[model samples]
Target: MAERASDVVPSSAATSHSDRGRMNIGQVLDVLRPDFGGITIPKIRFLEDKGLIKPERTPAGYRKFSVADVERLRYILRMQRDHYLPLKVIGEHLEAIDRGLEPPPIEAVVPTVPTVALNSDGLPSAESFARRSDVRLSRRELIKIAEISEELLAQLEQFGLISPRPGTGHYDTDALVIAQTARELADFGFEPRHLRAFKTAADREVGLVEQVVAPLKRGRDSAAQGRVADAVSEIAALSVRLHATLVKNGLHGA
Candidate 1:
């Protein structure tokens, strides 16, 4: 008996969809790395650690990604680049979408242009407040926060990895956070250079927080500003507490 041609070869539409429907790990990285300015291996692993992208495993335990994964990654990268967001916030935004919840209002993309050298004054032209004086350094003098040098910090700043104040020659508290994050990364042989995708993530997170704060920003009254500040504080505290509780439950519960 002769074999049927349809059984032997897939239709063009079928082949097209096969290309679109799913991808393997390498393929996903190939598609996404360019979007991330060629992210490093450790950075991809970091995303995995944060539960941002989960790939299925084959019988041989190879990871496999789908086209939908690519879309999600695109959105994730978009949020990071345009919004000045952190990964946790980006993950939360994505989580709400995955749960069939409406995405919060779409926001305009902001810039990641590096800040200029901060003068002694430490205030941005737009912001009237002083550089946050509340930053508590553990030491009185320059400390070994990391092996990060002034030049490396400059590069990070140039990529907007760490934002700065206008007047303070030194970086703001967030720079310290990045330095600490860099320290952890160095243990894995990842450098300040390797993880700049975090700047993209940070840009995305800022938008999320801005959207959350937008309604509160509508009025100019002192009362309104206080309410906004208090609300932000409460939300931040609750977010941390909730994460801790959920992890504790996961560890202790059946």
Candidate 2:
């Protein structure tokens, strides 16, 4: 979500800035850094480019942000981090806020995946379907809930079966499911060593898709990158279906 204009000036930035109800972008960063750990200059600039925020420009051509700007950014960041909502949906939410209407709760934006069903071909709906804001668990939390020891987790990480989100030191729900499944497999005498085949197959599939999208991703434009992402996603979903079909065929001696 991009930052939106607001009338109420947050008190924190108001007292700090000596200028006319505005703080330079640096000060705004400092004020927001506590809540937004990954906030960067480029991200702020992108938000401005997206028309999420319209900071006042100084005569010296410096960007100056008001107290409302800070609060608006905070709101935008929270909506993104907590809800994983697409920017369009969040933009609508912000528009509601601008109109003095109470926006729907963030949960309203989450797509509810049905728990059970199979198509005529016996394929799952939305294979490999994990929502963007799926469960985020820390290392310790995952270890405890998945009933896996630290040693097993270390092996899983070593084998690339599971790893934390880059720089976040946390695993998503998919990692949790993988860990639990690995533990169940271990009960049947399967070790992490046996899982290397699965990992290798996954890496090969990923490489194939990366090859297809590499050229599309070369462009720096958002639309081009979006196309690359969409291609990767479609390929991943198909890969899941392929794997499931192959396993079913093997079990049926086809």
Highest TM-score against the true fold, candidate = 2
lDDT of 1 at 149: 62
lDDT score for residue 39 of model 1: 58
Root-mean-square deviation of every model? 22.4, 13.4
Q: TM-score for every candidate vs. truth?
A: 0.37, 0.49
Question: lDDT of candidate 2 vs native?
Answer: 0.73
Can you give the lDDT of residue 203 in candidate 2? 90
Question: lDDT of each prediction vs. the true structure?
Answer: 0.55, 0.73
Off by over 4 Å in 2: 1-130, 219-222
Per-residue CA lDDT of candidate 1, range 1-254, in tens? Answer: 21111122333433454577656666666666665775555666677778998867789977666655556666666667767668877775566455333334444121111233342443222121222443322221112444466666666667666655565544445566576676677789887667777666645655665689889999878799877766665554444455457767999986
Query: Per-residue lDDT of 40-135 in model 2, one digit per residue for the tens?
Result: 999999888888888989889899887777777777787789778677887766665654334555545322111234456765344344235334
